[model samples]
Target: MSETIRLPHKPDAPLSYQFVPGQGPLSTTHLIVYLNGLIAPQSGWRATIDHLRRRWDEGGSRSANHPALLTYDRYGQGGSARDPADDQHGGSHDIREVVADLHVLAQEIRRTKMIKDADASNEDDGAAAADQVPKPKLIFVANSIGCVIGRFYAQTYPGSTAALLFLDSNIANSDQVSLFPDPDAPGFDPHVLLPPDSTVADLRRTRAGYAAHFHPSAPNPEHLDRRNIISLLPLSDGPPLRGAEPDEGTGPRITVVGHDWATFAEEGLRGSMNVPEGLTNRYVNPPWAAYNEGLARLTSADRARGPVIATGCGHFIQKDDPALVAELTDDLLRNIEADSAA
Candidate 1:
């Protein structure tokens, strides 16, 4: 079921969120939260969610009792209202503010689940049984810009987070403007990144939408400076996994899935774009891979699972291959379970 939850600080506006309850015992419940990319709505995850739910149902009794899914629209996108006037970022899409919102959402989910568990326990086994329920394990599944929010959240509240799944995530350092030819430079066509079927009208609409929600004070997406994206980077110091013990093979798991840049180039490069092939092959691809690799290193010193390059996919890995995503998520859950058991 879906509902709107008014932020305690901002009573005037509420965030739109949907929750799919698991079919298992409350003690072993797994909470999977989906974070969407910039400007993308929760509705964009419909296909992927459907596939995941089907997989969950097929797992029989063992899978049926755990792993609930939750997804929400960010402020100013989809059904969620715009940020309140008093917001620190003045309604702009600030990563910090987004992280704060996620923290609040996570807390509320825990609170709601606790209440539900208490009520069930009291009704079935008396009031004394209420205290026996274990807290739900949290797993985040984030895509594109959403990865920034997920990484920050995991760092800020690692004790509560069980794992993170990054899907074609963007790297803050990979946005260097110097790496690509200037769109305004003579003979450097701005339409290089545009799809073959896209018209000028489509480009205009896209630009308009970008200007509307993102902070005007910040650089545009194409010209974003490194400082603007520094917060999105994984913490160098690493997150605090409170109860995790390396000897037991249990700790927060980090999985990174990136698009195969070579495959992207094969499909994206086309007539008269004027972008140098060497620029993409030499300058872009290497750094892109390095960034993904760096993220894996930052998240896990042992590199439990190295960065995965999705061969047949583009930037939107989930959409390109929903089954792959579902499979990976299932693997992650099973790994978490095995670790916990150990």
Candidate 2:
């Protein structure tokens, strides 16, 4: 399914994607786009997609209400071409530019009949399928930095996003390392929350790892001043975030999901670096919870509802437990459909 199909796009930087046409009435069909973690490839979503496809087949075959599925590699990731403009811009892309690529890709998918009824013709002409039904609405199912991209995408293209399911978004607007307790800062107490085996060296190593992988724009795939976006879309306590189309009915019904505490400490932090479980529990978890909570409140509908904890999973919830992600996605779709009917 992952191929460089040469979908007519900017010749210099054509992205790669895996798209599956859906069955049933195409008018009701949604384009379920999977946005992978910052550095993770689109293939990371295989398990979740397969499980969701199975659920899509629950009622029937030819008349299944499954949404069209898509997963793509962003510029400089996986099989996609690199942004020629990156070198001029200090070898990183702006978050806004990355989202613009997504918008172009989505429009191309529709214009090229990428999401359509395949069985409408024997030859399976995409144009014929397109002639039969309307283009699908966008429903983003994103993870980590992908969630960041999704938000920008929705904002840029008003009324395009029908629903969103954010799977453990990154703590945007953060240095990520600063959230941890430093060993040398003012009034630093090493003995306070240290684990039995962890020492100052361990803490330093953890910070090093964080800095190497997660500093602002150096290692960050996109130039995301995450704080700015969060400020722009700060919860539904105020009026609609910035670009909300009043006609889009509450604007993108959003659901947030996050990793379990224990698993995240073990796999997300410790597995990657020398981070102590104590620091992770005390320092990182609270801020992470607050971040996801804030994300859930971006839209009016999901404001009161907190993030759905992925009890057995780590940062990569889909890989840890695909079934749960699939179930949540199916549930969100049904909710969106019901709202449309209402």
Candidate 3:
């Protein structure tokens, strides 16, 4: 079911959230939290969530083993309140603020679940009953810029996250080539061609543009150095990237899903920009593909899965192939279950 509720901490901004409870014992059911891309509402994930929920409910008696789904809109998007104060520069927020909001939301969910589990445990007496209280087993499904927030959250609260799925997500430092195109490349002259004075409003005009500019090649002109760019890469040097210290099994299982097609040319600012064919081929594609591969190796262990190419889709892979997303999510859940059983 869905509800529009205000967080006690951020009482002015109401968040639209949906919670689909899994069948059977609450203690064992995993919670899959869906984080939307830049400027996307929670409703964007409707098809995928509906498909997965239906599959879970219809899986016969084993339906009870399925994970619960939680999807929510961040502040200033969808049903949530928009803070004029927060809206400045190009966008409404920076990555850190969005991650903070997500942290609060996750904590609230855990708090509520703990209370419910406590109530459930009251019916029985024993060490086993005490164990009935649920420990958070959160699976994060992050798309685009949402991946940045997810990574930060997992790093900050390593114990809470069990798995992370990056769906057509961005990689830090990937924009270098696109932002600072090589001067030596054919038909490339940054000085000759006027860079469009694009704003967040301009990019939001189309989905492709939104995806392309979500993490602009250079958000600010002053800080384009390699060190600054590397520092800006999401989860590049965090506990999330390094995995939990002391080599405990608490690190999240991560997967990076990337679209095979060169979709930025379709509908966004990039399409409208009429960028030189040579520039797009030389500067854009290589770094993007390479960074995605780097994302696959972020974790120290073999826990990383795919820079998996989505054959038929573009940047919005979940929308293009919801079934594939569902399959991947289910597979991850099964893996988590197997590990727990072992």
Candidate 4:
């Protein structure tokens, strides 16, 4: 039967998770913990699960060995434990805490029995029977900032994660901020990045102009939880910087991105520009520059790994083309296995 697993986040407190075990007997040698993207839990992962189910049936014996899928929200979202401090930029909200939670979930899965067919005539498998089932290899399927958290975990706990499936994500060390005038730019900022005299009108006009261009993969506004989007806002007031701890190790990582929106927009839209004038390069550059640089550092750490490009998508690849995400996830998990075998 499906269940919930709680892990200690702060002392005397626990983080709650919804654990829906896959139907059928446990047959896979790997377990995939899918991390939800920026907004909230219960968003953007159904397509992924459906894709996996179809593949499991189609691929026959080969797919029968596919990993079990586990998905959970971060501490603040969904049923997870709340963080006392709402400080966006603090270590509490840092990628590390997210990583630690995944670790706890992984350990809990290791201890549990396979969710045997609910209709079976058999009783509990018992400890002896449970011991016979092999330990499931762990893989993390992450998106957006979730990818960043997974990357940190793999680097720190290298042996634990079999692989990472990064969908439309930034994997580099976000060290420095640069200016890019367009507000629609992936990492663009308006207020601090722009000049002092830049009016509120400038900010509103910039956001509106960009909003026209901000076509996420899934256009449904319901998919986003705007109330909890504080995490996506920049942690630091200024352009965010890449902060690397002393011992980041080389770990296996992979990235998948949808078609380049900026290039597409430049080509598709006609010449009349609606964005505010005098928006300096300074304002536009910092976030993307920092995030892109961080992505570079991550990819460089392991050349054999890749930043795989997915076709035809805006920011939310999970919503736009979940089939692509699933296909890529399969390949990524296989690669992780291959690396381990090698």
Query: What TM-score does each of the candidates earn?
Result: 0.76, 0.85, 0.75, 0.61
Summarize candidate 3's per-residue lDDT along 186-228 as a digit string, tens digits: 8954445423443323222322432444445433221111223
lDDT of 2 by residue, 154-200 (tens): 77777777777888887765767888778888888777756665788
Model 2 scores a TM of: 0.85
Q: What lDDT tens digits, residue by residue, belong to model 1 across residues 1-342?
A: 568888776678788888876655523356788988764678777778887777777863336455667889876667877766435543355666677777777667656764465555565555434345455667888897777677777666646667778887665644344444443457755466444544444444433432333333344332212244554454423443332233223347778888877665554444234233344465457667776775665444552465798878876787788888877777777776766675
Please name the candidate that would achieve the greatest lDDT relative to the true structure. 2
Off by over 4 Å in 4: 1-3, 8-28, 84-92, 113-126, 129-136, 170-172, 175-177, 181-253, 262-306, 336-342
lDDT (Cα) of model 2: 0.71
For model 3, how big is the CA root-mean-square deviation? 6.7
Best by TM-score: 2
What do the candidate models score in CA lDDT, each in turn?
0.63, 0.71, 0.62, 0.51
Model 2 — which ten-residue stretch has the worst lDDT?
236-245
Q: lDDT order of candidates, best first?
A: 2, 1, 3, 4
lDDT accuracy of residue 337 in candidate 1: 70
- Model 2 spans with C-alpha error above 4 angstroms: 5-9, 26-29, 60-63, 114-135, 193-197, 220-249, 268-272, 302-305
* Poorest lDDT segment (10 consecutive residues) of candidate 3: 220-229
Residue 170's C-alpha lDDT in candidate 3? 63
* All candidates in order of TM-score, best leading: 2, 1, 3, 4
